[model samples]
Target: MTEIDVATKAPESNATEQPAEPIESSPAAGPAVGEHCVTDRPTPAGQVSTGEIIKINDVEVYVSKPADYPHAPARFLLLLTGGTGLKSINNQLQADNFASEGFLVAMPDLFNGDPAPNTTTFASQEESQSLIDAFKLRIVETAKSFQIDMWLARQTEEKVLPILHKVIDGCRDEFADAIKHGDGIYAVGYCIGGRYVLLLGSDAQPTTPGPERPADEEAGETKTGPLIKVGAVAHAASVTPKDFASLRVPVSLACVENDALFPDDVRVAGEDVMSQANLEHEVRVYPGVPHGFAVVGVYEDATIRGAQATAYEQMLSWINEH
Candidate 1:
């Protein structure tokens, strides 16, 4: 069998307001109300005054919080991690933005050491050109190879969830008093990280999503699974409609309109799957942006920044609602 492709790839007001009008949750639908470059509110204030890297059970997570809120009560525990490759400057920035919104943000370096982001440059723009086609084929195969390795080794069971367990423990210790009152833990991921958090929604065992238990889980399990109150992802790669089959919590997916790696079909499939499962979810495609716009392009383009802001608000709104 061919390996599946693994593509190389914020919060609002405190006052409660009327519920947002639901966006279309199906792939075949057209754009929704807030899916465009529309910014009706002021830029959210960045309350995060401190940004530092902290160790959580030996795993390094970039931690950010309000200087005054160091011990302030948390509203939720946020596990924010970025895309397909290594962490980037922008990833930290994205995390900081969420932290500013008053969550106890924990963005972990799941891959251990920093690795370079995947790079691709095409020789031609023509759709029928052999060079372009070959390049596209290579991307698919490469992404597939990467996803296979991830599924075999770095998935939630083997790596991320374990890290999250430790990180949550560390947060409880670090914010001993404040974290005690948080409503719940929420996650926001980009690209590959997005895929991981989505996988958390599944009841199936990680690494191997099946009924057969791994040797470690053969005996009745003692620890609880990663309990995410809600999840939101943007331009996620390597996830499919089937992945959402058992997701019990609400999710908000922010898709890029022109993303080559995760295009309309992928977004539509996710919508279809979630709808079929009768899951509470929303799908919004930001118009005219490519993949990775939420983080990388937020600083480079005003239009992208606008889209990012909208996605950020919508994510927070969804989390707040649930």
Candidate 2:
């Protein structure tokens, strides 16, 4: 399992005083706990095989490969993580499912070997402060290792993007021979990972520009990589309006009607932002479901599982279309 050092932001006093609501109940009945059901079979393209971990910058990423060996070059599906890390049980299962569909899935560990606390269970404010400060210091040091300008951006992006670029580059280099045979590359993300997918689509640094732009001009758009065909899946998490305005790829936001973190109004606000941005996007809410409903085992409710299956089907359809 992949472990991530979770940074606990200080809880606001007002937030602490408020009580969290109960979990929402869903209408659709779903599979029971420990039930392993294969709703869809792999489309005749190939079988799925696990790939070895490869390092991109300081981060270690696990990959899944196609079994039948594509006659053409292989495309990739980059899996992003949420607040928690990629080793979550649900994430592993989702990765396995995608791999079975013949897409090379890359799961990067963003918080390994760091001083950040694994959980935010600190009892005292002082203790939490000390831990957070220490974690920030570690982040600064890590940024220095990559020669990145930490002052300019958040630690997560500063730490993550370089490694992501490296992985994309490595994929191209390692599979250059196969790529020459004509397979395409694509990306997908979930939660924070979903956000990264948007970043990679609109802001990835270009290592190589296809025929349209000169190599020198490409650097001017350092954050914009060659338009690699991409699709993104943003679950319960919401994107800021300004950021939504900049989205340049096909994306989908799946929301649960009763999500505690993002209720219907919040989700609608996010959807509105996307609409204003004029980006190709869609927002669908499953009635009576809660946040993390798509994740199997965590909720352990039949209704949640049913909603999850429906969401999975939606994602699969989007992926196939793109």
Instruction: Report the number of the highest-TM-score candidate.
Output: 1
Model 1 per-residue lDDT at 259: 66
Give candidate 2 regions above 4 Å deviation.
1-51, 70-73, 112-155, 176-184, 203-228, 236-238, 258-266, 296-299
- Model 2, residue 34: displacement in angstroms? 24
Mind sharing the TM-score for model 2? 0.60
The TM-score of predicted model 1 comes to 0.65
Q: Judging by lDDT against the true structure, name the best candidate.
A: 1
Q: Evaluate model 2: give its lDDT.
A: 0.51
Question: Across residues 1-322, which tens digit of lDDT does each residue of candidate 2 receive?
Answer: 1211111112132233333332222333211111011112122233333465677654677766666656534556767655444445455556767766767677776445332222221123454557779889678656543432221123355566666777677767665554443344556565546556666656434343346665556442454543345465635343333334335666666665555444455455545544444445656666665455554333445666677787777676666676
Where in model 1 is the C-alpha error above 4 Å?
A: 1-49, 84-87, 117-157, 176-179, 207-226, 296-301
In model 2, the Cα lDDT at residue 273 comes to: 44
Return the clash pairs for model 1, or none.
4-144, 5-143, 5-144, 6-143, 6-144
RMSD of every candidate to native, in Å, equals 10.9, 14.8
Each prediction's number of clashing residue pairs:
5, 5
- Tens digit per residue, CA lDDT, model 1, 1-322: 1221222111222123443333333454321111111111222355223467878788887776754575666655465554332245556666667777777677777666533233333233556668778888888758755644444343334656566667767766776554555556678877667776776655643543346655556343322444676888877765555556556667888877656556566566665555555566777777766566565332445777777778778777776666
Candidate 2: Cα lDDT at 206: 30
